[model samples]
Target: MNKGQISNTLRQYRLLYPLDKLRYLVERNKNKKLNEKFKKDNPEISLPPDYLMYESFQIDYSKYYFGGKTTAEWIFKLLGKHINLSGGKILDWGCGPGRLIRHMPDISNDQSSFYGTDYNKESIQWCKNNIQKVTFNHNNLEAILPYEDNTFDAIYGISIFTHLSKEMHFNWFNELKRVLKTGGVILITTQGENFRPKLTGEERKKFDQGELIVKGNVKEGHRTYSAFHPDPFLKLVFEDVDILDKIVISPKNKGYLPQDRWILKKKALV
Candidate 1:
C-alpha cells in the first residue's frame, strides 16, 4: 500500500475495530435472517451482506430503487441542457450496490452505456448479479482506476469525494480527467458551507481559510471520514475545467440536508 492508503487503513482500523464487532452482532444477523426469508420467495435474487451496505444502511428494495431513479432524473434534468444524458457513455464513480447505476437503463437510450465502479468488492459483486444493462467494476481506494484515457463522456460521483482526505482530491480529479473524453462533464457534490456547523473549532478555522478539513478518525473512504470544501477551494482545485454551474441548495428548498453541487466540463485538448 502507498503512504496514503497506509494512513487510511490505520485510521479505519482504529475506528472500526471494536464497534464493528458490536455492529455485526446486532445488525448482521438481522440482515441474514431477512435475506433467508427473502430468498425463499425470490430464489434468483441476491442481497448484499450487511457490511456491503453503505453506512450500514438498509431499506426496502423498491424504495431504494425509486430513490436511485429519482436521483438519476434530477441529474438528467440538470445536465440535459448542455449534454445528452441519453446517448453517451456515463459512469457512476462510487456507485454502491448499484444505487444510481441501476436506474441508468431507464433514463438513457439503448446505445448509451452505463458503468459503475466502487472500492467495495461485495457491492460490485452484488450489482453484477442483480442489475441489468450496466457494467460494474471494483476499484482501489487510491487514485488509479482501470480505464483507458478519453473513455467516458460523463462521470459523476455521489457523496464519494466527501469522505476523501484533502490530499487525495487533486490526484483523484486528475485521474477522472485522464479517463474522460475532452469536453466531457464531471458532476460532483461536496460538503461545502452546508456542513460548516458540524465542524470542530479548528476545522472551522481551516475551512474559513479555504483549506479542506477532514475528519479522519473514522474509515478512510467511507462516510466515517468527511471532508468539507469551500467554494474557492473547489475553483482552485479544478482550474483546468470549465465551471458550468455550482448550485448550493438550501435545506428548506430540498427538505433534506443541503450539499453544494458542481458541474465541471473538461477542456478540449489542444
Candidate 2:
C-alpha cells in the first residue's frame, strides 16, 4: 500500500480502537483509593471543586504507576548536588495532599521547613489530617502567597503548571518569584516533546488560528489534558528564573514518552 493509504488505514484503526479506554483503565485504578479517602474525609465534597478532580486522579495514578523513593527524595538529591540544604525553607506550590512532604527523608526534615498549599480545600484538609511537621493552606494562584517575600529557599511543583492556563501560569510565576529567596531553586515537571497529539486538519487549523488545541489521553473527571511543550513555555513564564536543567524521566525500553522534569534556580542579585 502507498504511504497515504497506510496512514489513512492506521488513522481508521486508531479511531476504531481509541486509546482513551486504556487511559480510563489506568485512571480507574489510580484514583480509586484517593477518591475513597477524599470522600471519607469530606463526605460533602463534590466533583469539580474549583481545582480539577483529575489533578488528584493524576497524582494517584502516578503513585500506582511510578513507584519510587519519593518525589522529595529525588528533588533533594537533585538540589543537594548543587545547593546546600542546611537551614533552608521549602514551599511546595500545588502540593496536593502533601505527598512530597510525607516522603522527605528524616534527616532532611530537620534541615528544612516545609510548607504546602493548594487551591483545593479538601486536599489541604487531607494534608493536615495525614501529615505532620508541615504547614498546609488552601490558597488560589491568583492571591499572594501567605509568606513574606524571599521567605523560601526552594519551591517546587510536580505536574502543576501543565494543567494551568497561560494567564494563570504568568500570575503564579510572579508569585513564586516573589516568595522565593535570592539564589533559591524551583523545580517543576510538565509534558514536553514526548507528548503526542493526533490532531485532525481542522484541529491543526484551529491551532494555527491561535487556538490552544491540546489532544491527548483522556483523564477521568477532568476537562482534558492541556499540556504544553516545556522549552517555549518555560522560556516565556520563567524568563526571570534561571533554568538549571531539564531532565527526562523514563525507563529504558519502555518506549513511552518521558515527562520533563525542570530544575530552575532563582538567580542571586549581585
Candidate 3:
C-alpha cells in the first residue's frame, strides 16, 4: 500500500487505537522542548494539557494559542461583516478544548454571548475549568444538541464537518438549522476540492461528480475519520439555506493545507 493507504488502514482499525495514542505520545514528547519554550514565553495564558489540545487541534502550545487566536479574529471578522456581532448569541459548535471559542470575548466587541460544544468529555471539562467568559458543554455523536430553538444568532464549526459519516451530515445540519434564529448565519469549514490531490482514483471520480468522500472505520468525531465535500454535494446539502459566501482557502505556504469556508444564512420559515 501507498503511504496514504497505510495511514488509512492504521486509523480505520479500532485495534490500532492504542498504537495511535502511542504515536501521538511520542510525537508530543519529541516536541516538548519547543512547547516548553512556548510556556516560558507566555506565562499568563492558561493552556490545556497537550493531549487535550491534540484531541482538538495541535499540540504545539504556541500554535494552539496564536493560531487559534488568529483564526478566531478572522472568523469573527468574516461573520461580523454579514451580521451584527455586538450582543449576538454566537456558538462554536464543535469547539475543541476552547481554542477559538476562548477568544470570543476579546475578539467580538460589546456583549456577545459565546458558547462552545463538543462531544469530547475531557475537552469540555478542561474548558469548563480553564476557559473563562464562555460556557462549554459536552455533546453526543448523534445530531442532537442541548439548546432551545432559535437560540443562536450565529454559529461556526471549524473542521467539524470533515470528521463525520455521511448520515451525520444531514442529521447535524438539520439540528444546527433548528437552533439557528431566522436570518442567522452558520460559518463552517470543510475539506473540499483542494484536497483532491490526496484522494485515490475512485475517491477522485466520486468527488469530481460532486459527492462527499468519507474515510471511516475509525471512531466518528476522531481526527482520523475524514470526510471530503465537493461543491455540488454541499450545494445539495445546504439547499435550504441561503449561501452568503463560499471561499476556498488555498495553501499559500507549507504546513497549511486548503479547505473550503462556507457562510450560510438560515432562511425564514414559510
Candidate 4:
C-alpha cells in the first residue's frame, strides 16, 4: 500500500476500534469541558464536542468558534442566490454534529424546516440531543435513505462527495434527486482540479483524463477514503440535473486545497 493508504488505514482503524473508542470518549469529555469554559467566558459562542468540531470544521481549536458559522454562511449564500429558502424543507446531507445546521436558525427564515443526517450514529445523536429546531437522523452507507421521496426543496452536502467512492457518488446523486422535489436545488462540493498537486502520479494522470480518482480502500462509508472529481466527470455523472453554478472555493485561502462547489437543480417533470 502507498503511504497515503497506510495513513488512512491507521486512521480508520483508530476511529473504528473499541480501545480507540474509549480513548476518544475520554478526550471528548475533556474537550467538552474546555469548550464549555470558553463558551461561558465568551457568553455568545456555541460549542460542541471538540472531536466532532474538528471533524466538521478544522483541527485548530480557536477556529472552531467561527468555522461553523463561516461554512454555514457560504451554504446560505449559495442557496439564497438560487432559490427562496424561506418556507422550504431543506436537508443538510452528511451534516456532521450540526456544524452547519446549528447556524441555520440564525440565517434562515423561521418558516423553513431544517433537517440533517449523517452516517455516523454518534454525530447524529449528539446533534439530536444538542441542536434545537432541527431534525437529525442517522443514515446507512447505502444509496437508500429513510426519508420519503420528494421530501426536500433543497439539499446541501459540504465536502461530502469528496469522500465517496465512484459507485457511491452516483448512488448518492440518484438518492439526492429522489428525495428532492422537482426543480429543487442541490449543492455539493468536491476536490476539484486544484487538488491535483496533492495527488499521486497515477491519480494525477487519471484526474487529467477527466476521470474520478478514488484514493485508498473504501469500507463502511467512512471519511478516510478520499475522491477527486474532475469537472467534466461531474458533469457527465450528474447529467440528469441542471448545473447552475460551478466554482473553486479555495483560492481565497492560500494554504487549503481548492474545493469545487456545484449548485444544481433537479429537472422538472417531463
All models: lDDT?
0.77, 0.64, 0.88, 0.79
What is the C-alpha lDDT profile of model 4 across 202-244, one tens digit per residue? Answer: 7778888999987644453555567888988898879988999
The C-alpha local distance difference test score for the whole of candidate 3 amounts to 0.88
Structure candidate 3, residue pairs in collision: none
Over 1-270, each residue of candidate 1 has an lDDT whose tens digit, in order, gives 543345456566685545655765665565555555556766654555555653523444433455667988787667666687666888889988876777777777565898999998878888998889998889998998889999998899888889897778888999999999898999998999877776666667888999887768865786567788887788888999999998997778433667788999999877
Q: Candidate 3: minimum summed lDDT over ten consecutive residues — where?
A: 1-10
The number of the candidate with the highest lDDT is 3
- Report lDDT (Cα) of residue 47, candidate 2: 31
Number of clashes found in candidate 4: 0
**Model 2 agreement with the true structure over 113-136: per-residue lDDT tens digits:** 788888777878877876677888
Model 3, span 1-270: residue lDDT tens: 554466566655664567768878987998899999988988999998878888777788888999899999999999988899788899999998888998889887547999999999988998999888898888899999999999999999999999988889989999999999999999989998778766777778999998898877778989877898998988887999999999987788766786899999999989
- C-alpha lDDT (0 to 100) for residue 11 of candidate 2: 44
List per-candidate RMSD values in Å: 5.6, 7.7, 1.6, 3.9
Error of 1 at 69 (Å): 1.5
Candidate 1 vs candidate 4: which has greater TM-score?
Answer: 4
Clashing pairs in 4: none
Off by over 4 Å in 3: 1-3, 11-19
Determine which window of 10 residues in candidate 2 has minimal summed lDDT.
214-223
- Candidate 1 lDDT at 165 equals 79
